[model samples]
Target: MDERTRADVERAEAALVEHYPRLVRLTYLVLPPSTGRHRRVLTAHGLVQRALPRARLRRPDGGLPAQRGPAAEPGYDVVRLRALRLALAYEGRPLWGPAALPQVWGLRLFPRVGGAEELALDQALSAVPAPVRAALGLWHLEGLDEDAARSVLARAGVEEPDAAQRAAAQLDRETETGAAALLNSAEFDPCTVQTRPTDLLRRRQRVRAALALVAVLAVGGAAAGLLSGDGDRTGRPPTTAEQALDPGRLLRTPNEAWTDTSRVDFTAWPVRGRQAGDRELLGRALRVWAAPPADARIMTSAGTSTRPPDHPPQLLYAGQIDAVTVVVFYDGERLVRYAEPEGATPTLHFARVDDADLTSGAALVIGRGNGWMRYLLAPWVSDVGVRDLLAPAGPVHGLHVTPDAVTDRIPVPPEGGTGCGHWPAAQFRPSTRIAGTGVNPPFLLTDLNDLVPVHLTSVPPGGAPAARAGEATGTPALQGWARTACSLGTLRGAGVRSVDNWAFAGQRLPEDSGSATWVCSRADTWRGPGSVTLHFLPPTTRPAEPGRIAGRARDTAACSSFGAPVVGNVHWRAQSGKWYLLAAGSHGVGGIDATGGVRVSGHTNTLAAPAGRNAPDEVVGRLRSGGTVRALRP
Candidate 1:
């Protein structure tokens, strides 16, 4: 009505008309996808058209502050604020009402179909809450920084705008082309859309079906009420135990069956626990496995399924260890372990060992507490010993076991430390039948945060045959492992099935320095590609120190049974106080070359050249076939 107010209204109207398409696109991106595409297009346009008056009449005390930077124009900022607020308010509410404006009839309008990337972006946006989508659109499509987006979100009535901004940034990082490119694609453009006719025949058929189903349900409800007796009528689903089979029906193997069976896997293990026959405790374990309680702690290895077994599972053990009740079950595909303390909630763990062999299925950690772990050995394990991997010549100590085949608590090995103190590993010798030979050698196994322990073995330095489980006990193999054992800490919680250390290359230093050995340690995991690490062991003078890491890679086939060549380089300081560049490769490599800071080449699998400290260089290995392979970096 007043002159000043009239001029402000005109300016706001002009801004709305000039930026109509951009505002509609922003609202369309921020609007929840649950509003079917046809309705969304019309709603976005209607909201922007109505934003001009709301901006002009906004209350001074509650209105949004003017936007900063390029969007700081008096009219554009107010109009954008009003439009964004209106779009956000549409979430979780009906898209259209009887008196709602801009309604379309007998037609469906939706954006054009896009490529796979656009479809993936659309689905990702739909998975998040509406406020997060708003932040993404403002920060990406509108080109606003994170701080500016947060301010806009706060003024538009989001309770936790900072959290939304963080979520948007994470989502952007996950996408291949970023959210900005996908939001700008034609797949989300409302102005460029395809049209289709409404399906009247399907609508009529759905109405009739709904009416008939309602009438049938009404009649069925009356008949059920007449047959029901008076009792607690609260309608709640059955509990987890009530839905599963009774504990009495669980499958159990005979105590002596393992002796005669040819299979050496978990199926041969007999029930050997003090509480093996407790039906009440078994029932509680079954319920927790079926549907864990809210307070229950759960852990699973990579690619393991959490679904409960469909049939009755076989019980392997149910016992008390360290004042805690532990239960073990095998469902043919998974090995499930459940532990419950006296006054604390239970913990459920699942691991996938469908392809486990005799060496891998020999032991499982049954209990762990106070920096110690107890293992349940196979029924055929006749002897158990603990060995310190860091001390090759240290005597092996005998480990005591109970009649149930569970060993006494053994100190857990140190994950990593400033010094190579000690690393404990379990050694097991099987019975004559399981060993299949007159002479039985002990197998070495170590826990790596999984249900089944990983087997540790080694290949001798001079290309001796690949060592079996027991062959790693030789003097040469043990000495090599003493220097390589500390590096195994990196494989913790990696789902590794086994690790083999190969003393592949040994090279004499260039300037009268002592010989150094190159050990390629490859960890084979249960899922995905295995990890490979090249370790550089200095001369014998530094026996107290662990091998220095030279190079590493993930998902590489080098140094495995397939015989792929691997190359690595390191900067070494000799006893003469001079630095040199040292490089080595596996057997198949015909030549090794180094470029950049130092230039050197060798026809054999090893090469060394004088260089400066921290000198940058690239190393490559050439095969007999003339193909080049890059070295794995540290």
Candidate 2:
């Protein structure tokens, strides 16, 4: 194994070759047209990347943490936007926050946003289908290649790969026409893109950026353990900005993201769990939804807010990160969800508290079909695997209705399906890294939110404290509770692991895939998200074999001015904020994960940014065995 160089390209290529399959997948959201064979393939490519979550790139001295922007220090806003895009792309659907797609796409559609409970959509061209929104986002905002764009579409649907290829061509032609309108629209300009009023993306980015970071920081101890635990200060700020955008925030009371009292029929829904109302949850869900999913402190005060009775009320429930049971009862003590948050126990307080009246676990929720249905969104009432990504809905784990309605756990069908149609790419896994390694076709995966499946089962039921229950010897031993699904055993300890591999596993410190030792302990939900701190030992072995090609290069559409020098074989995600230019075969730096997902070598990059103010846009320089990296422009 050897090292990788650290520098960006003189310019990036816009062609399919230039864009990494993962990046193409993200951009395909903006791809003008996604019916081509190219789009289909790109969709497939993206799906793979999402599942794999790794993007191979050259490292100069060592690897740099992935950034949001293309400069030594990227604009905070930019990184926030990119992260949101990634989250939304989890299920191949464009999960919108506060920000709108680039002005051009918005221009194509008319505005459908209204006051309170108002959603931001385009009426310009009927409502842009979820697919079109994703395409437009990738193409217009992310700027992916033609053929690459098609790859992403393939994941969504496009049984015929050949047709997907043709659609990419048509999409490009449509893009050119929209480009002119975009430049004239408010979005093309930086000022408007950043500061303009009336625009949602820019505004949402402000709030969403901050909130996103907060949520990430708020969740359970494992979340806290892995995220902002050690004072391993890179001197970098905790977050560039708050995730100011929360599309649901614009709703009347900020809790409008949920339907007041709608019947979410799970008789046929997958991974059953009733939604916790906005008000009933008190403000807990709002805060949690805005913040990260784990490492949250269940504070009585946090869920104690009140609301009017007739006013739209929100509901909430208590459960594990994997599954949260929804119970809407109105007893004397459980007036506001907050008061009863501590219903049976203390840790199990109001998942959300509000100023409303509530009662027993058995409550009535009126609806059209069932007229009156008992709403108990319990977690994993029936244990269903949540990994199937491409399905419209996964299997219904538990279908326990009263004997009269539907009861008993749905038997785990022996033949892998529930008579539900096959999901286009249920098993597709996309790499988290966007620009690195050879360009694979795009593919869609499950929604990031979907990853938060309502898993049920008695893993220390009653949300009991793990330490006291003695249920801490399993794969994920926790003092109180362990982060769901993710156990060091599965990816690190002898269970199909990798070393220094961010390509598949998450971007943890050191990122060692095999024999990767990380500390997972319960942390305080209130003070710090948790006490779990995952530490990857500096690799003693190199990650990749010598001469193993990595990194990326593309035309200008993805990077700079139109027709800029074709930046080829450049590095991928060297730095977060800055983009720089470097020549290939400079010198290998940092580390790489050896094949078979086991072994690691090299170190993180330590090169200086080439571009003066915002250099290092592209890190992961393509260096040789023993070469030194030099500035291309300088």
Candidate 3:
């Protein structure tokens, strides 16, 4: 290790030793078991041991540079929280469940304490919900003020403080004396020092055993690629259009629509006071794909005029050259183009898009927004190669592009599904035409199959089966078709949990799924019924060595963002049935608060830092070399 890092580790270790006693006391209080006090204490010790190596020590001012090793272990509270989560997970309870049940000894369980006192205490404490119990523990046991208690509760997923206050009052009335007695009990002393060398050695061995368990369970390999900070490109970025420059507006639509008409209704509008440079950039991005005829007039962007008054006016230009349609979008530095043939896919001779292709498009132009645009092109874009499009847009970031992005064809979806809204007519074909892109997107995917399928096992509240499925209720008609097409067996295999209608609608779909694209769009009742297009989705792409990093990383000061040092937790499960905690800390390096954790695996003794920021591979490397992984179980 370098002198600086070694020094930081030494300092942190010294702090760990100094704060070890207090850390144990806090863990015992937070996770007082109904029995087995000594065992629980040992577990808490191991958790702290494991957490320290991975923790980012906060300075007195709360800024992070764990190497500083402040006199006070700002990470003490973080250790307790991590311990609480570990205890809960070990016991198979919700990590955020109510504050621990009173840690009564043998006599209490066998009824040494007065029946009245025990009953009152049990009633009061158990009655307190998770947040309230946590609050009470912090206030009465830990002596934290209302604000501090509230902050802890909030981190534990409790938003409001009123409930905690109310529970505290209840505890005061019911078992104030009993609580005092429990605190003063001989079995629960927080200040007791463990001086026995043999006992300490034995405990250390147990901690090692726990670490072994984790290492055995952890998947071993290189880490997954770095995830993107920008969310999966499901929606367009906010436009920064200037409202003051109102030369001419484009075709404003209330909602987005996709139609077969190559040429949207286009009427030439004067550029009024628009900048020549802005116009030039727009032309270049479009010319790279397919240039419109010189006579083709530019139409105002659809839906800019009525954009919310607070939102930036959007600049969009649409034009047609015979069978080809070109639409350009500009939001300051960001520029996008939607180029496609009038009714058929275009044959592009260019192998890839580059900086020279689109002058200002360098690195700034994100390609995931061009979802399914690849299908419209011949000699489809390669998963790894499509990144070339962003060369002109600047540093090209990687994203998990769907097969439809490269080719329009997919395996024939099961019977009963149909295309809805502006979706093209369904064309049943083989899946080979659209092979899966075998990499996870840095951001999450919001594909059609990701939707939760509602099964009408029982009629829903406020409506019948057909009535319950409406436009406002998220493509119920398509959902119904999905329900019919997939039997209970299929749905179960597909991970669609069937619930009563109302409850189902309120639930969220899982982050990942293996089903194909199930398109549903709103239909105009007056014009005709909506459509539901179905395409066989590719197999689910599983991370090679799947793992998660539950922590924060440094976001970019600008583009080319990397996951800098962060304080968080890492967990991994491999195909070999290994599941283990890679690291735990209050301060984590490299921010990665995404859905699936970044993939990472390696020897517990050695660590690797990622080569680039925001790259999945970078995250894996950070976790590997970021800090020492303690064998102690979380």
Candidate with more favorable, higher lDDT: 1 or 2: 1
RMSD of every candidate to native, in Å, equals 12.8, 28.6, 29.2
TM-score of 3: 0.23
Q: Put down candidate 1 lDDT per residue, 1-634, tens digits, no spaces.
A: 2212334556778888898888888888878887676678888888888777533354343665433334324777777888899889888887786313477653567776554457668889888887898998898778898888889999888999999988888888888556788788877888787665344334334544776657545753442332221212566543333434457767788877766776767887788799989988987788677655545676676556667656678899999988999999988778899999999999988877776666777888898876789999887788889998888888889999998889998887786843548888888887776544455677788877677788888886756313322346777778877888888876766668888888888888888877888988888877646778899887875444688888888777766766577888899998789999999877777899998898888898889999898888999998887798788887
List the global CA lDDT of all models: 0.76, 0.26, 0.31
Q: For model 2, give the 10-residue run with minimal summed lDDT.
A: 493-502
Task: Go through the candidates in order and give the clash count of each.
Answer: 0, 187, 60
lDDT of 3 by residue, 59-113 (tens): 4236544344453424455555554444434442432213333332211111121
Q: Which of 2 and 3 is the better model by TM-score?
A: 3
lDDT of 2: 0.26
TM-score of predicted model 1? Answer: 0.66
After superposition, the stretches of candidate 1 with alpha carbons farther than 4 Å from their true spots are 1-244, 435-438, 462-470, 542-544
Task: Quote the lDDT for 597 in model 2.
Answer: 16
Relative to the true structure, candidate 2 has a C-alpha RMSD (angstroms) of 28.6
The best candidate by lDDT is 1
> Which regions of candidate 3 fall more than 4 Å away from where they truly are?
1-16, 32-39, 53-73, 84-130, 159-162, 178-181, 190-634
In candidate 2 the C-alpha lDDT for residue 158 amounts to: 34
The alpha-carbon deviation from the true structure for residue 293 of candidate 3, after best TM-score superposition, in angstroms, is 91
